[model samples]
Target: MHFDRKNYSDKILIDLYEALLRPRMIEEKMLILLRQGKISKWFSGIGQEAISIGCTYPLQDDEYILPMHRNLGVFTTRKIPYSRLFAQFQGKLSGFSNGRDRSFHFGTNDYHIVGMISHLGPQLAVADGIALANMLKKEKKATLVFTGDGGASEGDFHEALNVAAVWDLPVIFVVENNGYGLSTPSNEQFKFKSFVDKGPGYGIDAVKIDGNNVLEVYDTIRQLAENVRKNPRPVLVEAMTFRMRGHEEASGTKYVPTELMEKWAKKDPLQNYEAYLLKEKVLDEATIKKIRKAIQNDIERGLEKAYAEEMPKASTATEIADMYAPFEQKVVQPQSEGKNKKRYVDAISDGLKQSLEKYPELVIMGQDIAEYGGVFKITEGFVETFGKERIRNTPLCESAIIGIGLGMSIKKQKSVVEMQFADFVTCGFNQIVNNLAKSHYRWGQNADVVVRMPTGAGVAAGPFHSQSNEAWFFHTPGLKIVYPSNPADAKGLLCAAIEDPNPVIYFEHKFLYRSLTDDIHDDYYTTEIGKAKLVAAGENLSIITYGMGVHWAREVMESMPELSADILDLRSLLPWDKEAVAETVKKTSRVLVLHEDCMTGGIGGEISAWISEHCFEHLDAPVMREASLDTAVPFSPPLEQNFLPKGRLQQKIKDLVEF
Candidate 1:
């Protein structure tokens, strides 16, 4: 390969050498620490430093980069302090995640980098979001994202590429074909000729290059980045390399054939690059030796500083306090002078309309949500009112859209994603539970993304379409869940969820979309999350519920006026109003927790246990729970009615009140 002197000055060439050398030294030293048990684990980028260094060298500081675990050169080339990087490895308080996460699992906003979670494919969609933000702002910025050969096979990889191409997003997808994915070889991973061939299927242009040659890697990435920046379209680059070490220090490379290692050893990126630089008279042996010595000394000092740092404090209360950002629970008062009767679906539309007016950067994304106005028509005429930029339609790619929303949130751009149905959230479950739910805690990045879930069973949409799935996200930390029963609360809670800085799961009951109506206020308002609404206050017993259960409880109470029972509508499941629950339980002397989800593993079980533990002394009877039967939602309407607890709720409440 000929060195392109026109593109690289001697100074730039030497800098690239140092950039490649730094991570090599860091990994060499870290492996020793791993053996000594000072560090927990190690994922070495020993032979593949050129790929990370080369790909990152041409990027502007403002252009975002999302790197996988093996891309240590991305951190080193960005000039992250050796001390902080060492502290992160040692799990000290001085690290980026403040010891909340370990190894390359953490990301740093200061460097315009988003690190990968264990699930590697979601980051590709996240990169699409960052690229989307750049395009929306009309800035000349691009996003560089990395994935392995195995990672390319993931659904997110294909979904992200297809969407990026469809939107013409400025993203450079780099696939490092490192021969092995953990222990599995490339033969079993894919049947295609190469990742480059897979790109054309997604309507993307792709090329292949020698990843071991730093110059080739740098030139290829630089040219692609410039073209993408000017034209704003995604391109793929496949870098051929080999992983000389195991996936981690513990996972030995026994599955790899011995001859393969011997072949790759001769083609080491650092050695070959150094030999070329020497042959080109870029630098002599003395200069190379001096650079190595300096890097070693720097590593020593960094390790020493990391060793002196203290571990995170041993306090559960402190850990809990830092789990979520502080949100001001605003009190909203209803207007008494308006004739504003509205359906639940209309109220949601009003809330979204109001939110778009308030937040300039707010975007709403879902399948057929643009001119077609979504399956429920909640966004009817929204594209004309808000423009196509804000009210956008998405492909049936749930995981990619959620990851894109998260990526937009990373750049301080708020987004709202409506799952066509609550049950469909299972398709995007990994991105939700692993990425959105953990981003805030793992790093200081708030996922200001609201996921609107059309939930509950009643319309005979089948088991796949009809489900009350709030309990799925209710159990996860770093998420706020709000389920509203009527139009007023629906609109108010929707606004609140949009305004919240953390990730929020906003559950809209599909059945209540048209079935329930209220005189909702015409003006913008916000219902406080973690607050319960007191409906039909009484002294005999308390019916604690949310979503469709609120309507069922209200119906049962209306039919049986003789039983003086109060209904507590828990609007928020995660930060459920413990104060309201206690007050209501103490006042009524008996409580029944109800929900539309299946009986086992429902949110009602947690509420019932909480009441038993805290309000045991004030209770006149045992904490009772009324929920749907523990079985898949029946598609048949008659069977569905039997499966639901609504049919027997009146009798169960009567028994509890009598007992």
Candidate 2:
């Protein structure tokens, strides 16, 4: 598998040798450290050094690469200081994620690298997002992303390829078919002949190469990447290689056959490549020895310095502050009030329109959200005004689209993603909870993306479409949840959510979209995110609610004046107004938490627990909760009406007041 020596310069040949040698040497040192308990784990990439070094060497500084756990060459080749990377491996304060993430789990924007999460598939789609940014900016940049033979089996892999092909995005997917996933053989992982064979089904160009051959990997990837950057389409390169050691240092390779291991050992990437370099007279034995000695010295110094660095402190205040990016909730009241009445849906449209006009970096993505508008028609006439590039319609792949938006955010592009229905978000739940929610805290990366959720019940849209699902994301940290009750609040809260430098879940009640109307300002204005609005103030008892529950409480107050109480609407759920809740609780000495979600695991439980713990002395009665029945929303109108908390709100308020 020797390549022609005449095709490459001496510098390129020498540079490739250095790249391949560094990771193998580093991994060897790290394994010794792991045995001494200096580091907790190591995934050795001894035999497959050629794939990472070759794939990474061809890319420019501005182009991005997303690498997996075993791709140690990505970090070393990118010229990240060896000391800081060792500190990251040791969980020291000086690491890239400041000790928040470890090993190859962390990413640095400075190196134009995105690191993989333990769930490997999401990063594939995330690469699409990076390429998407390049396409929108009209930049001739290609995104290279890596995944194992095991990871290629994930749904996100297919979705990512389809998305890149459909949009004609420049993304080079490098599948390192290392013949095993952990202890599972590649034969058990997929039925296809090779990953390259499946590329045509996605309309992507494909190639298979000897991953153990450094020359072939470098030349093939370099040439293919050039074409992709020029033409802007996804291409798959299957690099056939094998792991020379266990998946992790701790996971022994007993499951692998002895003959197969021996067979792969003969084709060792670094060993064979180094032999060819010496044979071709690229470097003398003295120079080779000098290079090895230099690499070993660097590794020793890096580990020693990293060990001396201080460990990260577990300060409560600092930890809490680091959970979300700093955001100031400010309510900008209109200078001159003018009555421009509109339905809840219309107000959301206005807010999005204004956001689009205000921020040129803003892009909206969803299924049928472009020329067809959204299923709910929230983005009607938007594509005509904003154009398809900004008002993008995405595939039915929810996970890929969400991950794509996160990728775009990484490139400083603000994105607004509309979940076709609140229930449909389950498909993208891992991306939201695992990737998006953990992005900021994992690194200093701000996921400045708004996820528009059309939520709530009472429309008889059945179990799948009509459930009140705000509670799902409310429990997850590093996310902002905003649920508005009326048109003005809807418009204002949406504006605030879009501008906030955090991942915001903006829930628009499907039932209230056309049912409610109010006077919204013609000009843009923002309602404070964490501030609660007092719809009706009274002292008998307090009814704390949000979204449709606000209207339900208002109805109870109007119908039964005897149940006079302070009705506080908590517009934002994550950083909900604790001060206002305390004030109302202390004022009335009684509280009733209400929501449209099912009674058992709903937000009402968390609210009541907090009230019980913090405002214990102020309570004249136990904190009461009124929520929908703990069952799926029914299709029958009668059962649906009975399932909602609105039917029993008056009685719940009466009991709280009487107590």
Compute the lDDT of residue 633 as modeled in candidate 1: 91
Residue 603's lDDT within candidate 1 is 92
| Shift of residue 534 alpha carbon in model 1, Å | 0.7
Give one digit per residue, the lDDT tens place, for model 2 in 592-621: 999999999888899899999999999999
Model 2 lDDT, full chain set: 0.90
The global C-alpha lDDT for each of the candidates, from Candidate 1 onward, is: 0.90, 0.90
Model 1 clash pairs are: none
The ten-residue window of minimal lDDT in model 1 covers 330-339
Q: Candidate 2 at 539: error in angstroms?
A: 2.2
